[model samples]
Target chain A: MVTIKDVAKAANVSVTVVSKTLNGYSDVNEDTRRKVLKVAEELKYTPNMLAKNLKQKVTKSIALIFSNFERANGKDGVLFQIMSGIYAAAVDFKYEVVIYTRSLSEQQNISYWKFCKDHKIAGAVVTGLKTTDPYFQEIVNSDFPCVVLDTDLASEHTGSVSTDNVGAAKVAVEFLISKNHRKIGMINGHEFAVVSRQRLEGYKAALSEQDIDFDPTIVVNSDYSEESAYELADSYLQEHRDVTAIFFASDLMAIGFMNRCREIGVRIPEDISILGFDDIVLSSYTTPKLSTVRQNFHKLAYQACEQVIHILEKEEKGRHIMMPFKIVDRETIKEL
Target chain B: MVTIKDVAKAANVSVTVVSKTLNGYSDVNEDTRRKVLKVAEELKYTPNMLAKNLKQKVTKSIALIFSNFERANGKDGVLFQIMSGIYAAAVDFKYEVVIYTRSLSEQQNISYWKFCKDHKIAGAVVTGLKTTDPYFQEIVNSDFPCVVLDTDLASEHTGSVSTDNVGAAKVAVEFLISKNHRKIGMINGHEFAVVSRQRLEGYKAALSEQDIDFDPTIVVNSDYSEESAYELADSYLQEHRDVTAIFFASDLMAIGFMNRCREIGVRIPEDISILGFDDIVLSSYTTPKLSTVRQNFHKLAYQACEQVIHILEKEEKGRHIMMPFKIVDRETIKEL
Candidate 1:
């Protein structure tokens, strides 16, 4: 319960002097600052950040607004990895992180801008936001400082960070083609997701370049869920028996497809080769392992934090930042 | 920016009336309160929570202090599920949740009490703390409202929530015993963790109940890491050739043991049965799946938040809460 007044009295200084010294103002004498800090430590006086933020009209805090964060459970560890990266960067920058989970439907009643204002958030890093969401439009049109993940939205104060989905997908498909598999199919994620569309485009580009006609009938879409992919796998396999290989938009979907293939006695790589994207941890543990494009979610989240902080500090303009991706060869793919 | 003064002026009311109305003070007349709210909405005014907290001397905010949260990456989604539960309860209770990641070493420089004070945190729910940690002692001795996860420390102001590890472990081991396995070994997690100790006790209790002598030499310890378990598995298997079954303290360790078993040409269930604790998402996807005990991390975290909030609101005395656990049967175990 020790206050600034107590620290001032103990240090034989005025409250203003104590405040300036504690707030790290250069106007305070070095000796006086040292004495004030010593007294404050002895008194165990902790400054109230709420009052300080109110008085200074600034807060050294950011909100990590995650849409559909509940999906993190029973799924891959992508969101958790992103959270770790965000926290690491927040620690380095000495900023506090507040987490807010919002479903897509919640935007009708809540505004992200007002949430930031009420919480005194200096900036925000949002993920899992679709372009069609009401909050996405609000963020795109507003001047509030924000960094989005895996989205193409950018504005005067809104930036984005994501892996080069198109290029990575193309490289993966090309690798499959190099293995003498010309009849390649695709299992894409939700059509609403930007990365899904980008990956699909890459699939087509790789097919056209290799003189393999792009077959729309062989392409399937899942809701980025393992169960959905599992359900789609049986029918997709039955209809496309000539497809020599298949590219999956995510590791989770690939895992689901593999599970179904196992049940139906379809041997991986022997019957059909499989390639996956977003090399989640499970990719390494699957029965035949998995060949995947590894996107560093940690780096993506770290850069998103840095981008928002940079925008808030006026050190950089908001813009899209594409992180690097790597294609990892494992047991799932086979040469003809 | 819209202010209280603007709302008051537009509503033809005084600033004090506007403030009182917005703050939900019952002293304001109903019609006046409605008028103030309507004007505030029209003006697009969002109340500054920082300033309101400073004036009210109470904050509707809680901190989720996670020790070694970085371990969440590339691992199971236990932490993420806990986070989801905490957020869900926070929303229901109308409280804001702020995340704080602290390593054991960080306590020397930062005190939890000071952190809660500075951030105006009404209470806190901390997870992944060891009994030997400096912060554990602080929580035990301090009067600050807190809820610790998976620890026995509880005080007049500090509560705790965890699964009934001893009972759950005993049940799992007893099931293995029922399968006619006499020579059973165990791979426990870090010795510093309370759950590890509790589960070890449970393992011993099950042995005693079944009239089987406990063998300390066969019980090895890992750091609850897959790599550590994988390394330990080779030596343990080589030395304890007579062991018919093994119980693991965590699913991650179990998976590691399974991986090592696969590499060393040791067939699971046929050669030796395996049981694990903490049925994480990976348990369902492993080669033979994993028969394990399931602790509801989501429920534990939700109850921890509720406990802390209850203590803060003077609705309940801080005490330890033991949640139920389940035994999940998969493909990892078999009759000897």
Candidate 2:
């Protein structure tokens, strides 16, 4: 078996320096740490503390912990894009990522440390978790290295990554306004989600900027699901037929509304313009292709992984990262 | 700190039976095995032989090893569906799954056993691997418990799971033939994939059954990519306009062809009928929706995990399982 001595010799470093570097000590110089770690990895020198204790002290691995687990499985949405970024970054950083989920029931039953210890995970990136989830609190308190997506815990140990939701929402609504759409309605996600609140603020900000009074009656809070958005749009359209355009918080909801519109004989762009957020995979493939605010989930995931790994390596403090977003102009939006 | 005695006592089983059950001895009855394992899990009685030796005797975990590493990150495809199934099944079976990939360079640099031992994965499910891969042969010869997808190794320690690609192909082609289309063109994925060959056989079988002459000029081999398929369709349409319908071995290719057709002024169903395989999530949402063959990738993944676990438990010899497939009809096809 390759030993620390071999790696230290190859890197021309003392065993003490090698040990400190492997254990994530901050005193090691960046150049020396890089040389030592690179040599150790090339030699495949895994610290087999498993022989002394069943739990490993360190491993070149990360975990992607997901809440609302179904999103982890859906490929047509932001989750897949985020995973793509994480996977690419993991390959580049020479780390393996294990995908897992801890349900509400499991959260109450096990400590986050035990979960990570059992899996021998070095660090983690968490996504889709709501603030109310007990696991969220556990993550906030645990000293374990982690980064949460689309939520801000403001912890020293835990980082956060997300799109500039408020800015992206404002851009989407402003695009509609630029197209002379004044009677614009909005469909937002659940109130408890940080993204929903941020997006709502953006919507209101855009309306206020245009001197258009925010119509509370025209805004509907949905559960970020297509079925709920579809039903909401169906009823909202029947009562508020004068609304020229609608802005949805997610592409799934936009797609659902489009499906419902087709059933009700409402033509897209011609009868009513639509705007969506996230620009999920389905958004581009759908007929008349949805025009929406494109949040780069891949960049968000990449930043989260990079931040968590940097924290693990003791190279940087945790950061609150907001990835870039832009508007994708397609067939869904029309000039009145 | 829980021991075999506690688990045995809680489950009303002998310590010997509990040991045998945990160690994967088939002599233990099914009910007794379930009871003992459940009790052991509840008591958190993980065998800590890692202290004595780095190799663990038993672990409640499986490895999902993917080939073609790109597919692992793609959400708009069958890979995601398979992963979803595996994740769900693993949660039910009390097994933690680790997802990993061994690149061709990595495979050549390390022994398969060493790779598994380093990761401490008890068993693995390998998907998207070509038969020519060195790791595939190593897996086939090794005693490690495994289940492979879309390929048959016929190894006693390994099982295979896939839709009846040949049969599904025949059904799809026959559906096109039934609509009075005689000059049918087939676009196939790379020939190295077992699924590609099987689907080819199916296409030929359908033609043979209908007593229609198969023309070599009308067939195109693509690399299972939309870009390749789009280019092939573009060129094929320019040269062979007489071909009334085309059967693409994958939905991605069909979608690519559709996009190309639109660019070149060809109409679907009106100018030519179209058929696709693998009815991905986007298939249902596309314009005129896709008329294609649907393979239940979720069930395919579920069975792969179940088979791998069954092999790990020493319950039965690994079996080659063929999942069912069906033709999904929508607006993409029309009777000639």
Candidate 3:
């Protein structure tokens, strides 16, 4: 097969000049272009049809944009699972997946849309960006095809995939209520996260359903970190001595809270029942185990990638897709 | 900037014709080639210099080749940490990282060297290959730069980074000896893994150092999976009632063994003390907090990436680099 280099050699000009002349750039002089063309014809060099077609259409490439893939020995269960899912899905779709990890600070200066354009990406799957992030504004205004994980933005080209946090949280609290635990406290992640707000709503909805008055003092906000959860749980357990159970927004937090309980000699289920969300792997390994709401992160990721690919392939607007959640009953919950 | 499309239009030929004419194809008629060349020259189209340069040299790209990224919510701690480290280092070096995941069977057909050549990768960091793998034999013969994790092969272009498994295992067994825990047993990963063989050597060395005769009957081989370890440990514990302490080759296996002990009415440390290797994140969170040898996977990864990049940029041959390991004292070990 003939190559671009052969064409350049035959034309007596650089490959770049030949490429520019063929690619519709506006800089080549007509005389040089004519000479190069004449030599290429005499040499019988044929342009690669595949390369030409590739240039004519949008490339089948997607970006998995993450913010801080966590430090080592860090809690990255959900993130890892999601990445695995996206990669697996991309393999099936035959779309190339490129990962771009940017810290929150770096995200301020990097436009996600511009990044996609520069990479010639057809779409992107974004994760770990807060709603208040400047990138969120860029995402909302741009027409780039994007599917965000665990976050929502109203845009024609942007889709979102997250578990039904409100419903899951309600189920978690309701399960505790069924066990006759009315004095249940809530430990939530950062207020900036949309899931946090939705979980809080679910908690309140469960309380109202059970005719139990909502207690604002029992709800503690944390930064979705294990250490923060431990600290917050320690303080909450110290002050709210009467509270019989607590619902944590994440399994990592629940583990931290359980560790705190061990330190304080507070027995799970006997002294207080606990429920968590996103039943991470550690939840099952913990002694007495943990009862929590499970999010289908793999399915969420698959759907997110599927959605973005759909929009790109079909030229259709994107929509939010919610994954189902279920309550996993283990040793963490007990009846009064 | 003059473009090929413009030249093609002016010369009344397709872009491919113009491209082929300038690129030196011998298939085009001499008359048409002359016309296309003249048109391209008149347009003053300069080929892209960056693209041309890219074709002349090896791309600054590296491959993170892995055997299976397991589907379990298991201890992917080392794998995840190493990936994080490699990505971090790649960012500093401005190298692009591509990941290739293929099973041993798939690897039998895919030549690692060819993969790098096809992808234009300068080097690769390989993980999870057994010593007997056919790919390892290929790697031994190929001059492609590679830094393998937890394995050793004698090749100038191939380097390896892993914790001193033999020394670490020796230290672990010696710690048990210091605690007066004689009659120790071992639960090791598959023999195909170089680490497993090293650990076994270290175990025997420790026993020899203590003037104790090595008992081959007490050592059991597992597939390095948590479930496999659980079954193997259960059977081993049931049969070897005389063994007082057991050292697991991996933390996941240790956790599984501990869980098996729970089911079989054996109390950890009090009944049969256990020590584990690879202080995974969950090791610290386990009920009794596992006492294990900590592999600095992050550092190993950083060093591996650095070494491969050095070989690529400086044209230096690679060498094996061993990372240090330390024992983390926790509740799992009891002084006999």
Q: Which stretches of candidate 1 lie over 4 Å from their true place?
A: none
The numbered model that scores best in lDDT is 1
Candidate 2 chain A, poorest ten consecutive residues by summed lDDT:
A48-57
Model 3: lDDT of residue B183: 96
Task: Report the lDDT tens digits of candidate 1 across residue range A1-336.
Answer: 788999999999999999998777899999999999999889989887777888888899888987765665647888888988888888889998888877767777878787777678899999888878889888987778999999877788999999988888899899999999988999998898899999998889898998889889988888778888899988899999999899999999899999999999999989999999998888888889999999999989999999899988975778999999999999999999
Give lDDT per model, in order: 0.88, 0.84, 0.81
Q: Which stretches of candidate 2 lie over 4 Å from their true place?
A: A1-49, A52-56, A68-75, B1-55, B68-75
Give candidate 3 regions above 4 Å deviation: A1-58, A71-73, B1-54, B71-74
Return the lDDT, model 2, position A83: 69
Model 1, residue B209: C-alpha shift (Å) = 1.4
Per-residue lDDT tens digits for candidate 3, residues A1-336, read 456788888778899998888776879999888887877767656564335434564656688887766631446377677867887788779776767787777777656765666455679999887888778788867899998988766468998988988888888898899988889999898987999999999999999998999999999898777788887766788799989999999888888888888888988879989898898888887877989899988789988998899888897787888889999999989899
Docking level for model 1: medium
Among these predicted structures, which one has the highest TM-score?
1
- Compute fnat per model: 0.81, 0.43, 0.11
The Cα error of candidate 1 at residue B252, in Å, is 1.0
Q: Write the number of the candidate with greater TM-score, choosing between 1 and 2.
A: 1
